[model samples]
Target: MASFKEEVYEHISAVYQTAADEIKNGLSLIKEVWPLIFLLFLALAVLIWFAKPAPPDKVLMATGTGGSYKVLGEKYKAYFEKRGIDLKLVETHGSKENLQHLIDRKDPIQAAFVQGGMIAVDNLSGVQSLGSVDYEPVWIFYRKNTFNEGIHVSDRDIAKLRINIGPIGSGTHAQAVSILKQNHLTPTAPNLLSMNNADAVNAIEQGEIDAVFLVDGYESPNVQRLIKNPNIRLVTFSRADAYTRLLPYFEELGVPMGGFDLGKNIPDHPIQLISTTTNLLIDDRLHPAIQVLFLEAAKEINGAKSYFSKAGEFPVYMNTEAPLSNEAKFFYEKGTPTLMKYLPFWLAEFLERMFFLLLPFAAFAYPIIKSIPSYRTNLAKKQINSIYKDLDKFEQNTIQTFDPNRRGEYIEVLNDMERRVLASKAAKLATADCYSLRNNIEFIRNALEKQVIYKGR
Candidate 1:
């Protein structure tokens, strides 16, 4: 005999009550899964803690001073500075010294400019080449008297050759020996001079030296003297192509007629010469970020046309003594990292390394990451269903225990279970479940009242 308004209110109250209990049950299940969440969070923290150290903030390089290596190294330093890195450039005796520094792993040097042909591919182990940056032409200037005055020294008269190749422990010196060796000179080739470009030029000008071998480009200041002085003649290789074939690092290139001066028409025609490229060498352990920067700098500085190469001809993809590093290969294949194109260098580098870490985590933890909701729902449902089963067994006990004393104990136990079910509602429970647990509580109360009325007497 309830009014329509009262009935509607009662229905709404029941619905809200059911929803509250279902949610509380769900929360109890979630509480059971707390241990899983705690462990997962701990693992994530460890991963972040042990992430690879930030890309090196700086690096040291070995290069030749007062030459293209020094000049180009300066340009590279500038480029690195813009990207928040510092380059420590150390000047050394040319390619040969550079190679020694790289081989000595204990040294702090990370990179250097080494001329090709100085070291054989077999000898290179822990280092790698980015690529040849530019062609290092072999400029041989000799006294005109050797050939013009009929004073040419025969093959065996190398003792009378009186040549200055370059100083010992230098790229030009190595190239000089290589060239002489190809001509069948022994390791201790006689009359081999050890002098730098300046002294070599002075000696040639004074007729103190018969010939001078310079491994550099037309940009060399000494080469200018050879070009301008009519008393000196460039020694052209008659079998340049054959030399190139014998030496993997050698290339048969020509110094174009009038290349130095169109007015004087220096060579009068193309003169054949054997040359090697100046390759940038890197330690195998150098940071990959720095490697990419070196390549980018080389492309910018050596990609232009020079006396020996056309525009975009340098930073050659050709192989060198040391195998190319993986970073160099990647740059050659993919140009630049996709992230680097948009983000700042520091940010991009950090994110790139992080992505590598996250990639593995995402792959290996796919199941772990996915089981969150599954475990949550399972725990929630388990809690909800467990309470219902306990109630069922208690209800059966009440039906079976008909003795007054036993029924009184059953009622007490039933009351205690209802109190526990209501207490569980204090926890954070799943909201979707709409079981208030009130009906079950009411059933227990009614059963207890029946026991008192039917059996208490």
Candidate 2:
């Protein structure tokens, strides 16, 4: 018999009442779990504080003034630039200077290409290795006219000749000193000269120097230029095995006949050379993400086949004077991280940090989450008990007063108490207790009504 407007109004009222009840319940639930919520936020804040910050946007690497090291650095720079990072190449004299830069705590250099045998493994403290990238052959080029044809080059012959052993801080200089000392020759020999790669190459070409000791990759411009030069001759290490025995870091490499130029039959016979590994070293404090990026760049750029290396043969763990980095070890063991393979570098790094951050938090939060339900139930019970205490006081007052004239007022008070209890959010959770309370209120009301009837009679 209700009109449409009346029905609509009633429906709207019911909807509003339901919404209000839900909001009240939600607020009550939040109150019960507020401590847990606070704890979770605190834990998150701690994790974020301790988590490794995002990788630096700009990184500086030490490379040689001009040679394969600089070229390799340029390649690495290109790789990093594609991933939204700036890789600045700092020009150094060579491996010794590069190693010194890495060892200096105040230096901004984070990475460098260090040759094997330059530093003793036991001496390294602040630097670590990504891996060996390639072979740096010790190319001893001499003017053919200086040494008779078919005459084996001897240490005495090299000791007497004017030779450019590279600049003071170069790997060529270091190795040249070591090799000369092993041959009972001193670095202070008047014939030994210190010169840069270009100057040294020019000296040898113009016949200013008898020979030059170059420690560089086969693909290096200076090495290639010397290889193609008709007047210059590469000295074959006849005692290569003996040298490798004395210098354990040196490896024997064989260059097949006509390897440099088949058409001209350059080096017409097979040659034996002693070489050391080109190690990629980084500062111990470098960020792990950046370390991983270096490893990946090594894989992409240095993993290819070259005259001295097979495809996928490089970026291998070898001749590392310093301990291998954790990131490098992980890379060699597991390959690139799965997320990095598919995601953008920055996004992958963010997700990786988030994953590490959340993993421990999940472990920490599991027990707390599991206890929430029990906590919520206990909170409801506590609220119900407080209401019961109020009811008990009211009932005790009613019993003690025993006023029949005010029995109607007591009934009204009981009705108000019932309405408040039913409206309580806790009442819904402890439904049995709520029903029992309502029943008790009704009983009190009935008792009051009966008392009033008896008194009236």
Which stretches in model 2 have alpha-carbon errors above 4 Å? 1-32, 121-123, 152-156, 370-373, 393-420, 441-457
lDDT of 1 by residue, 1-457 (tens): 9999999999999999999999997786557666766776776677778766677888999988666677778888998999899999999888888888898889889899888877674567798889888877787877777774444223233334888878987888877777778777764666788988788899989999888878886666667767789888777776788888888788888777787678898766667887888788988989888888788778877887876788887676664577889998898888878887788888888899889778766765677757867776666566656766877786666656556557557767766765665555322354344144546656776856676434543
* 233 Cα displacement, candidate 2 (Å): 1.5
Q: CA lDDT of each candidate? A: 0.76, 0.88
- For candidate 1, give the lDDT of residue 443: 70
Error of 1 at 268 (Å): 4.3
Stretch of 10 with least lDDT, candidate 2:
448-457
Off by over 4 Å in 1: 1-53, 121-123, 144-159, 187-190, 205-207, 221-232, 339-344, 347-374, 384-420, 423-445, 452-457
